[model samples]
Target chain A: MIRMRDLRKDFSVRVPAGRLRREKRLVSAVDGVSLTIEPGEMVGYIGPNGAGKSTTLKMLTGVLSPTSGEVSVFGLTPVPQRTRLALRIGVVFGQRSQLWWDLPLRESFRLLRHVYQVPPAEHEQRLRRCREMLDLDAFLDTPVRQLSLGQRMRGEITAALLHGPKVLFLDEPTIGLDVVSKQAVRSFLAELGATGAVTVVLTTHDLADIERLCDRLVVIDHGRVVHDGTIEALHARYGSRRSLVVDLDSPLPAGFVLPGTSVAGVEADGHRVTFALDETSAAAAVAGLVAVASVRDLSVVEPDIEDVVARLYRAG
Target chain B: MAETGETWAGETWAGGTRAGAIRAYAALVGGKWRSMLSYRASFAAELLSNVGATVLDVTTVFVLFRATATVGGFTLAEAILMTGLTAFGFVLADLTVGNIDDLKRYVRTGQLDTMLTRPLPVLPQLVFTDLPLRKLLRLVFGAAVYGVALAVNDVPWTAGRVLLAAVAPLGAGLFFGAIFVLTASFAFWWVESGEIGNGFTYGGRDFTSYPITVYAHWFRDLFAYALGFGFVSYQPALALLGRADPLGLPAWAGFVAPLVALPAVAVATLAWRTGIRHYRSTGS
Candidate 1:
């Protein structure tokens, strides 16, 4: 389990006062945030840029000490017992690599085995699992520098899991991956989550990553968690409405509108229109539209998570 | 089951034990050595260049000796002893833990974050990861020079002298190693302090390469006595040579090289701890 109570971190920065003078100012990156993560729970931690997401991760991983508050992972204090804590937690920073640049991918894994002191049997089992699941056999002998970004990400994920850490923290794991590579990574994480042997906390700008992998979502803004619950709960809280797109047989007269729906967009050809539906079922909305006009084709589009999150940020 | 595994794995990991630390260092250093050798051509070329550089340093000392019968009241033979001690200590440190001066680069590149996440001491992790096995030739050359210096001096061997001879070079290595760590730690607070740190680590090596009497009075007082570089080579050389200090210090001061290292080691350890505590990792 991971527990944090009133955790905070403040950094003193220097900004130029004028041409030759500078002054010091204290900036609170994480401010009095309290959170609890249970074992086997995969939570998606999302926030806007500069929302103290990285700061909170750093404190939990023992990379940075909190200015004030209590933080514990499996009952061990992070900062004072970092080395001990490191044995139980694995962290992957997507922007930074933890592998040796000049060595072959296989060699980096071997060295990490020694660093983590994993038993040979356990190490081989994990390595085999990772190789088969992540398709790492293709580039096992290739130097890390020569691997493409997608290949390197797969190798990184493998490295983090080789130690069998109880908790895994991923920051922007799919930041720049292409479509197919992103799917591979997402599916691999989903499989890992299914095992229920490792607690995973991941932060990403890709909401698709969350929707596909995480069951619970935590949204942070301005150093505070503005919302925490299931995706449906978030949609309900923000009044996120589904939209209906209708391809009509002909154009409707100007100012002729559906009784229970609002017009979201209309195609230039006037043959297609989108309506925002509230509480009304897609069946009812389509029926009402069909009664008013001849419908050629129709579909319902789920609420955009990006739009809901934007509204939540505005409300916060 | 996972909770039990966490506690059990933490116990077996050996990160908190002496044996564990040793195994970790060996793995890192061994990996780095192999990594360097993988580029056979580059490793061979770097080895030759390293030997050439070591040869040049010795040639410069010989060239200076040709200009005068004595430098600062010490003969060629005696001065060579001082050079040998200084070179041995500095090279020992340089080839092993000297790469720590690259702390600024690590901090800038975020490699330090990767290291901190590991279950090992950060200083040793950084040192062993970049261990310069290519400089093994320099260490050999330094020991050879010290050997020749011992033969030419032809000083009568006493029990105490033999002990000092063996212990002094090691003490000097420890002293310079502490200097390397202390200077490199300046990067934590001031990222641009690289050049300033070099002025102490490398500059201290050059300053201690000659007799303290060779420098101007005030300069010698500040760098030699005040900063403790005097005990690194010159004072220890005087003890081995059994010569009185022309500057009027007690002869026993030469024997205190190891003793002098204790304080430098303590201070460096303290500075390193403070620096690690104050580390504000780069923004993502």
Candidate 2:
């Protein structure tokens, strides 16, 4: 559904001095990034601050043009003919809304329907479906400005999807939502992807959002993609290290070492110990710890998505 | 479904300029108008403030005329007419282009990204987003004042003169509006310089409210040639008042007010397109 090759975006900004002197500087926001997204796939584009995730999304949505290379959305170049591409794509910026602030949610949807030239029958059908799917009927009459953050986000999702776009670009769609609201948004997005009619490119720092809604992941750092693979693949690749916390009933055997494990830290009580084991066997590490300590309590800490991405960047 | 896709693709390639632009602009204006109507008290207060400001300005001009007896070869009645008409033209421009002045805020707050993704021209979308209906009250107040001044001063108002007067204000409004658009186009490159555009728009109005000939030779020529404030108010009023041309362009120049407005709008639009290119490349 989307193809980007050798995509680069640079910004030339003027540096203001005290009175009259000024200088121009160029900062490359996105550099030589190439990506492809398949139809109906939910992909999470994750990166640290200023890692060019938003810039890449903007390029795909035709909000920003690439300094070099090509971007095609559903077989059409986004920059050469952006207005047409807009008709087929829906975008939701988490920090901002596209709805008319003082007007009711229904009015904004009606205006969009007319603007998109949706046939009346199709418009009504889509409106009903979106409202039912998003549970928006209760607040449809309320002004958008009056709606709660969650309600406003639901309204935004409905507004973006009312035209039945083939692809939805959600830039931090769940940024400020509460836990319950985030779950509600995630479930709706999941169902939308299940239908196989819309492709979603979700860019967010919320790793939980990535874990729940995205199957494939693209991790970008410093304007480059450092890792791209399925969530399972990433987990298997970097998530091999395990930490075992062992609490012994009795104190100290001095200088006792376990095979294939290094003691990470020990508690002051001298009965608790932590070990970092290589990616060999969890069973063997637990067995080795059981032989040396009483093992009053045992816990295994597995690697998470956030930790994996952090380690990947650190290694880079 | 294939046929629908084909139709959509065809419309997309054609750019959908006619119905798409019209529908988008109407929706924007309609939504904004509805929002404005929602806050009745604030709306009323805004309208009242506009009326008060208009009255104060007209009164100042009237008092000045009483002291001077005439300004730049124009009688007291003619000066009142000029002030009234210019006031009306300015109010109309404010009503239409008030939102264009707020484009800097859009750029600064990053709201321009939302506008860029829409399937419409950003300028029209920006203009339609906020209509500022409060200024309409000011327009009416200025028109009423102009009417009373013309009646009390015993200036003859024939049907042709009345028609010309009505159309002249619209042409002038368009001319000023074009200037606002051109100025707003600069926000794409120099974000902080949005206020600089205001210097030409509101500043030109404030300067031309008085007789242009009252100024020095260089200032008058600068305003005439460089800024073209004469096309907006001075020369049009010269023809309307049946006075000899001060700048001495030609007898036919006043009749081409609409033509003059067309080019200003065209140039402004060209600047806007160029600005969009800059925005796309720089992302600033």
Candidate 3:
């Protein structure tokens, strides 16, 4: 379990004052943020640039001491009890490579086994699982520096899980991955989450990653939590409408009326129409559309989480 | 794989034991050694160049001696003994604890945060991860010079002299190790302060390369006496050579090299702990 109460972190930065002098100014990176994350919950921590997301993660992982307030990860104070807490937590920073740059991927894993002091049996079991799940066999012998970004990201996630940490913190795990690689990573994390063993808190700009993997989303802006709920709740909070589009075999009449829906847009001449569903379900809108027009194909598009989050940031 | 509750029941969340820590260090150091060897040509070049650098230091002493009978009231043999002792200590520290100078880069690059996440002491992890195995040959060369210096300086066969000769190098290594750590700790407060530490570590090595009498009174007093670089080699060499201090220090001061190292080590440890607390992780 992770619990933080009114956590705050401030950094003192030096700025030029005049021709021959400099001044120190205190900047609040994280201010009055409070949260509680239960075990086995995969939460997406999202924010704009410099939103104190990384700072909060650092404080949670014991890398940075909080300037004020409280933090408890697995019932231990992160800073004073860092070594003790480290045994149960794993961190992956996508922008950085934790593996030895010159050694083969397998060598880094083997070294980490000793670094974490895992029993050989458990280590081998976890390695086998990661190797199979993450498809790491092909590049196991290749030096980390030679691996592609996608391959290296897989290796990094594998390395973090070898010790079976109770909590996993990933910062932008899919930041630079290509489409195929991103899907591979998302599916792997989805399966990992299905096991309900590790509590995952990940921060990323990729809403697709969040939409596919996270059941809960926590959005912060300018060092404060502006929204914390499910994605559908976020859509409702922002009044973002869900739209249903239909491809009709024939164009609807100029005075055609579909009840409980409004025309969001018309595309592909009059053969296609997008209906913004009101408080009614997509089924009701589809039935109303079928009754009114000869529908060939139709699909419902949920409210864009990205736009809702953008509005959340603007409000914050 | 199935999610097994038994795995969690069997999990050991206890902190690693001392034996486990040792295994961790060995594993980290061994990984570094293999990584270094992967670039065969660079490894070979670094080893040779490291030895060459030590040879240059010894050659400079010899070249200076050719111009004068004695430097600051010490014969060439005695000066060489001081040089050998300084080299032995500095090289030992350099080979083991010297890479700490990269703390600035680690902080700037956010590598230190990665290290802090590991369930081990950060210092040992940093030292072992980049252990300078290539410097092993240079340490051997420094020891050889110390051996030759002892042979050239006769009258160093007494029981106390034998013990001093045996332990002084180790003392100097500890002293220099302290200096390296103390200076590297400055990075936590000032990330751009890289070369500032070299002034104390390498600067102290150069200062104690000759007899303290060769330096001006205030200069010698500052680095040699006040900072205790004198005890690293100069005073210890005096004890081994059975010589008196020209500056009127007690004879037993030479025997207290190890004693001097203890306080320096303590101060360095304190500085390192305080610095770690002040570490403000770099923004992502």
Per-residue alpha-carbon lDDT of model 2 for B1-284, expressed as tens digits?
33333221212233455876687678778888889889989988998988898889888887887788778877777777667767877887788886687877787777888877777767777878878787778888877866765565643466656766778778777878888888988887777884789888877877767777788888878876676777776666666666667756785566565456778888998998888777742221
Better of 1 and 3 by lDDT: 3
Superposed Cα deviation of residue B177, candidate 2 (Å):
0.4
On residues A1-316, what C-alpha lDDT tens digit does candidate 2 reach at each position?
Answer: 7999999988876798668988888888888899888987899999888888888988998878789988999798886678788888989987768998999999999888766666666667667766777889999999999999999999888888776678899988998899988988999898777777778899999999989999989998878988898888887787546777778897648888777878878995878887887644667988876776777887887766778888888876
lDDT by residue for model 3 (A1-316), tens: 8999999999988899998899999998998899999998999999999999999999999999999999999999998998888889989999878899999999999999999998888888778877888899999999999999999999999888888798889999999899988988999888888778778899999999899999999998888998888998888878889899999998999987777888988988888899888777899888877887789999999788888888888888
DockQ of model 2 vs. true complex: 0.33
Residue-level error in angstroms, candidate 1, position A23:
2.6
**Model 3 TM-score?**
0.94
For all predictions, the C-alpha RMSD in Å is 2.5, 3.9, 2.6
Candidate 3: residue A70 Cα off by (Å): 0.4
Candidate 3 residue-wise lDDT, B144-211, digit = tens? 99999999997557888889999999999999999999999999999999688999888899998998
- Candidate 2 interface CA RMSD, Å: 5.3
Top model by TM-score, which number?
Answer: 1
The residue ranges of model 2 lying beyond 4 angstroms of the native Cα positions read A14-22, A236-239, A250-270, A275-279, A284-293, B1-17, B145-167, B280-284
* Backbone clash count, each prediction separately: 0, 0, 0
Give me the candidate number with maximum lDDT: 3
